[model samples]
Target: METTPCRMFPFIRSKTAQSKNTELTVNGSSSSSALYKSNFNLGTILCAAAQDSPQKTAIVYDDKIFLSYKDLDVAARKFASLLMTGNYAKGAVPCRPEDRVAILLPNIPQFCIAYYGALYAGCIVVPMNFLFTEREITGLVKDSEAKVLVALKAYGTEPTKAAKKLGIPILWADDESSCGMQALLSSANPLPALIPTSPDDTAVILYTSGTTGVPKGAMLSHMNLFLNATIVPNTIRPVEPDEETIVLAVLPLFHIFGQTCMQNTTFARMGKLVMLPRFEPGEVLRTIEKYNVSLFAGVPTMYIAMLRCPESDKYSLGSLKMAISGGAAIPVEILKEFEQRYGIAIMEGYGLSETSPTCCSNSVRQGRKPGSIGHPVWGVEMTILDEKDQPVPDGQPGEVCIRGHCVMKGYFKRPKETAEAMRNGWFHTGDVGIRDPDGSYRIVDRTKDMIIRGGLNVYPREVEEVLYMHPAVAEAAVVGIPSERLGEEIAAYICKKEGHEVSSEEITEHCKRYLAAYKYPRKIEFVKELPKGPSGKILKREIREWHKKMKSKL
Candidate 1:
């Protein structure tokens, strides 16, 4: 039998002979087994890839800037030297376990330099979204107790003000003649060597979007990130070091997907990443044609926009092999249309900031099944539990819980929250899902999002799926709005097709036939567009809050 690579090594045929770092091979064929290994540091993985492919193009932007492994090393060294000249100490930066260093920048080389530089200096990196409001920005900075903030020229004001309010210094990377990279690389100083970080050391303090309330910092360790990046790519496909993989990095690096998949994963595999400040469908298609991009990752909204692009067919996207979708659920209809049109499959995955953002993903080799979030990644365990916290039968909807290496250390400084979320050694994902007989999982809806109407529980996804079947409906989101009679009533927010028109009565009538009497949406609102997060995820919490304010006015 021919041998193939395994993402996670399987155990020996004899069960009792397992080793910590054993590589499993079955019947003289590696493809038949998975590999089991001990955890490694994420920094080591990045440096190793940089060393292995010293001359390959690492990043490409508007002007086609390419950073060879050697170049990145030297540039990082120079930036490191500049950082060392500051309050940052030579060894480990002497930070308390939860100390945060805020990073506020756009999708430029400085973001990476500042990010890795902070980590190399042994300070916990808090990557703030550059689009945050002043109050929101200050709240996170004060909450995290960030000592230093790095901001790009375009979005430096908010960070500067926040830093000033908090009595912290801001490092601005604004240059007319040269960019942040030019300034950092031109500095005459010796870069410090990489810090010796343990796998359990807190590498980043990723602040959640705070969709629910004030955002809380998710403390991810080197091990948490290392496990995710190492396992995700290997399971999806075996990437060769010499393969010239061009990745379209439109997703923000501050988000977990872009950080792990595009930044760290690309670095580990020695692939080239083409950066974009934001997603413009035509521009993305043009860039794809221009650079011959091979790999792509984005949220569902991007795929929808790209498909709706009038000039989508004008570009030759034959180079695209795979596209990964996360941040929100990908509609099966959209997935089919994209695959049919572009000859590329968008593999949908599921995760949260609490789990390094990639707990499950559809496998490229194993044919994607519509609506499934695929199997669990290597060294991770997943289970579906009922409201009572007891394991539910297969094919039954329940809350998804995750455990193992990819699980975050915990919420930063929120011991009560950490304890509540990680009960019984499993991080309780608020999202509800069901496991099929084949071990694939499908998310039903969020546990908190289930609507209770006159004592009957209705999963919002069930109602949304029905609404999506409507011919005129372009997008739909279901939420529970407070009602005087029913306690909570199902409210459907709809965005219709450009030329089509639909009324609230028609939507309610359409739902009545396809859904249970109580499951049908009682109230409806038609909007030109749905409110979305930076990643294009429908902000359900934001919608719910808006509904609450409207009801209050009534």
Candidate 2:
């Protein structure tokens, strides 16, 4: 039995916010209108677009599968309809809008349908990385208390293990089985009523890098996501009205960078998002040449990888007009070389999962500055503040704090940590940065010893925790070493237990079994003793400096 459409969806069409431009300010001065409608539900970004252009192509899957806006809406409705059955649906258990539903998927049409579908049902979406190991996935599900897990068919056995362990219902997409996505979508049941959510209600719970402690989930509200998503497309890098916006969504959709920047922005713009599950330099070139992709939202290493591809010049990627660089800093030399080769301007930005993943970015207009993340986007206020929360003088390095509409609601289930992070009315990003004379911000370094390898954040503590579990390992300190190809390469320095000898190859392979492929340390250095401060804390900075000196000599 399905709820009546009229009762379920109070507004069949997306409603515009009453105070349209009421949510923004420029550097704490002039007020700017909200970029997109924040008053409405996030799912309505697709609904409004579907109603406007039902037959327009919205999703392209590896250039094989295509879904129009109407099809996507119906698909979302179908997926939502399954969740509405209150245990009557073949695969899904009763899922209320308040319950968390963790999504584990790669870049595919199902990722879009499942994400929006969860939002459509009024459920909080907890997006998980598809490359996570069984234990990692299990921990996230347990932490988030996800009642129902939606995953693609190719996820292998990890999802099943986690679901069974958690005693939760698992819905599989791309499968024709009874518990598969198609079975639910094919149901004749009507769509459920929309569970109206407040703008401040948490829309997504994005997990932060657990460098200092266990990864904390950042609670991003509907307004937070909506405001941040709009700034990039509307102000930072607006697609020309006549241009058919084709975004290369190669970044993992589970991360906030890809979700808000590529996936949501494309749908909001009523443009096409080409889904590539995993990034391959060769295939990326092929997809661009085949589809004439206009927007390439990628990290610094991706650009380096593409340039290093053996078939680099074999394919014509001339269609790319605008590019976005984030995740990690790109060497100015590499940035210049890439633009010259690709003939596209790569605008740099800085953000984290907490700030809807975008606090400061370079706009397409006049404020563009290479090697510097441009001024705070409309409605967002960014500052370099000292420990006392006082604004530091310009050109001086300090903690980057962002206060704006895009700031996350708080950290989920961890109020103390949230208080620490969101103290004094500013979300403190533990990144050392300087505010240049032109108000543009440049990242000097990270206060937190986090590593960005190939644009994926590799928290040293997480890797250290894993290494500590090995029987042969007594103590381990993980650090990042510079690399031209990858922004940084992970290196683990270990002091083995007496009488226990383990080969580096064995340790690396062991890590591969437990961690993601990119997370495993590429180099393992056996040391008798690691440098430590008087307080007994490992001196990671000293180790980094040591590596730099050694590399220079080599």
Q: Write the per-residue lDDT of candidate 1 for residues 1-554, one digit (tens) a residue.
A: 11211111111112222222322222243311211224334556656765687666777766445556555554554444445444232222323323566887767766776676566544678887888777887988888888766776677667767766877766665543333434434532333345455689888888877655567788899988877777767887766565677888888888887888888887777777788978899999998988888888988888888887888899988998788898877788778889999889889888888888798888877768887889887778899998889999999889999998888888888999889899999999888999999998999888788888888889887888888888788888899888778788888888887788878888888999898898998778898888887777888887888888776321
148-250, model 2: which lDDT tens digit per residue?
Answer: 8887667758888888888887777666765466654654233433446778888899887565668889999888888777765677866677888888898
How many clashing residue pairs appear in each of the predictions shown? 6, 5
Alpha carbon deviation, residue 243, candidate 2 (Å): 2.0
lDDT of each: 0.74, 0.76
TM-score to true structure, per model: 0.87, 0.75
Best by TM-score: 1
TM-score of 1: 0.87
Best of the candidates, lDDT: 2
Which pairs clash in model 2?
8-193, 8-194, 21-33, 21-34, 25-379
The runs of at least 3 residues in candidate 1 whose Cα sits more than 4 Å from the true structure, single-residue gaps closed, are 1-41, 87-99, 176-185, 240-242, 552-554
